[model samples]
Target: MKTLISGGTVVSLDPSIGDLARGDVLVDNGLITEVAAHIDAPDAEVIDACDRIVMPGFVDNHRHAWQTAFRGIGSDWTFPQWAAAMHGTVKAHYTPEDVYIGTLLGRLEALHSGVTTMLDWYHVAQTHEHEDAAIDALTDAPGRSVFCLGAGWGGGDSVDDDIRRVRARLSGGGRIDLALGMRGPGATGIDTAAREVKLADELGLRISLHIEAPGVITALHEHGLLRDTLTGVHANGIGEDELRLLADAGGSLSISPDVELKMGFGAPMTGVALAAGLRPTLSIDDVPSVGGDMFSTMRTAFAAQRGIDGGLRSRDLLDFATVDAAASMGLRDRTGSLTPGKDADIVLLRTDDVTIFPVTDPAASIVSHGHPGLVDTVLAAGRVVKRDGALVGVDLPALRTRLLASRDRIAEAAGVPLDGTWRPQP
Candidate 1:
């Protein structure tokens, strides 16, 4: 199938193409065929981009997708309180069905918001059934995904079988990749970190570590477990040296400002990561307390970055969401910029929306004024997952019903009633 997105401002993040005031993008099969000023593909399907800001689809570096069922229940939670509640009762009651519902909700919501590629930091695999449910939901979604399999905070048996099963299941050509959702050195000791990282390396899977505190990278590096395939999440409290260490080791950092600042994890590492010569990727982290929208993630990151480094620009943040983000997931060769020969992971944001009508600068408009509502169309792997401002093939009512049932059952089993504003009492 051939599709030509004709005549709009195209912000291809590809340095060669740059941003075109008026451009056209042609997609054949599942890859971008051409990005030029004009493309005369008479037989192809034409998507009018006259009022759209066409760009590469957003890539999220880190997200706890299974927490979608508990959205906003931790709004007033601190790091400690949230850990206790989220990792304690609710997690214990999670069944295979609950994980399936949550993963479906999260992945679908992510697509609606123009996030085509994401790393699901999955850690609720209490049993093989739970693992199956999560991976099944990932395959069911119409987007590029990385299943970062993890053991829960309480620690479980070897995840080798689960990881191997997933790898074998998704071995052939598809949109999903496998990774290790590790606890890292700070949370787990060095010996355990080394052991797990070695296993990931042997299996050829990327490692996504939660850099919970400072010196985590240093400690891991000292143990010779730090590798290029590692991606550190929430390096909020880490120092500049730690950032440099990560960069020197050829690893990437994912800054989730919303979760960090709100959860008292200290300030975002956006500015420092940049200063340390590392292109930091951005993510929503977890939607349990925040919305699963990449626009919100970009905006929060922009605000936090600009506050620390006044010279920060919207295009830089856009790069973090697009190209840099894909690099973090180790899928740069596949997606992340609107370049020819790359996967057609694209998003078309309408510039005619009430808040976006006066599109002065295209990239700036997307980073600053853009919202999920402005996302008029999205194409993942050259397939139209969302078009005309609605998700394709998704039953929202049915999904909501299933989600509610799952939440209710989990809450009941955990003996914790979920209130609209469930918080830690003084």
Candidate 2:
């Protein structure tokens, strides 16, 4: 199987190859084979990219895909308030089928919006059935994903067994990866955290933790458990010392600027990440609190960082959403760039639209104003998952119906209206 994306402005994101004003990308059997100014391949199927901006698909390193059914539910709440609602009431109402629908909805939406790779920080896998259901939905969807498992609520070493069981169940070497969506030292104390990290090492899996408070990195350092496989999600208030420690240990961060600012998690660490010697990665965090597309992630990180000190450029911010994000998610080699030898995770954004005319700047235009609707073609692992602005092989009506039903059911069970202001219980 072969695909030739001909004559598009390619943002290779690789410094050595550089950006191409007009280039062709060739994909063969799920891998990128050639990228040049022009390619002549009559045997391959040609996709016209004359009026598009061809680039690598976005990578969202941290998102609760299983919470997609609660989209926009806690938009007005603080981090603590949202946590109360989610951990206090809503999650208990989730059924296994609900998890399936939610995961499917999130992954499909991500693909449609040109996010070829995502790390699903699924913390609500309440049961064995729910875990299986979430993984099943993720596999069924058309995108690369990491199923980062977690212990439902409170910190416990009990989830180590769950991770071992689930990891063994998953077939190795595929689009879906298994990781530990851990409570970390923030929720679980250092002793338990040490145990969790050891377990992750034994299983040979990565760990993505919510770094909500200070001392978490310190705890990991004390235990000598920090490693490259550890990724801190939404690292809001950690100071330079913690950042340095993380960077020294080869750790990474996934910052959701939109969620951090709105939920009062403190300013995003985009500028700080750079200062502390770590390449920052952007994420949606959760659709219930922020927009799902990488465009929003890029712009939000840029604006928020600039609002503080004013340094990040559009090209640098674009890297946050693409290559940096892929590296943070531990998927740097498989995807993240239009370079040959990587998977064909690509997106073609239509540049002829009124919002993006003149063709002055590619990276700036994309980072500032690119959106899901502007995405015309998407390929994940050389498969055309989306074409002509619509998702391929997806039953829209059925998926929509399932999503709505799941949302309503969970909301009703929690004694909350699907559409109204949430009132906190005294």
Q: Write the per-residue lDDT of candidate 2 for residues 123-146, one digit (tens) a residue.
A: 885789999999999999997998
Going through the candidates in order, what is the number of backbone clashes in each?
Answer: 1, 0
**Candidate 2 whole-model C-alpha lDDT, 0 to 1:** 0.87
For model 1, the stretches where C-alpha displacement exceeds 4 angstroms are 154-157
- Model 1 Cα lDDT, one tens digit per residue, 105-179: 999989999999988888876888888898889999999988888877735356677778778888895777889
Q: What is the C-alpha RMSD of each candidate to the true structure, in Å?
A: 1.4, 1.2
Highest TM-score against the true fold, candidate:
2
TM-score against native, each model: 0.97, 0.98
Name model 2 segments beyond 4 Å from true. none
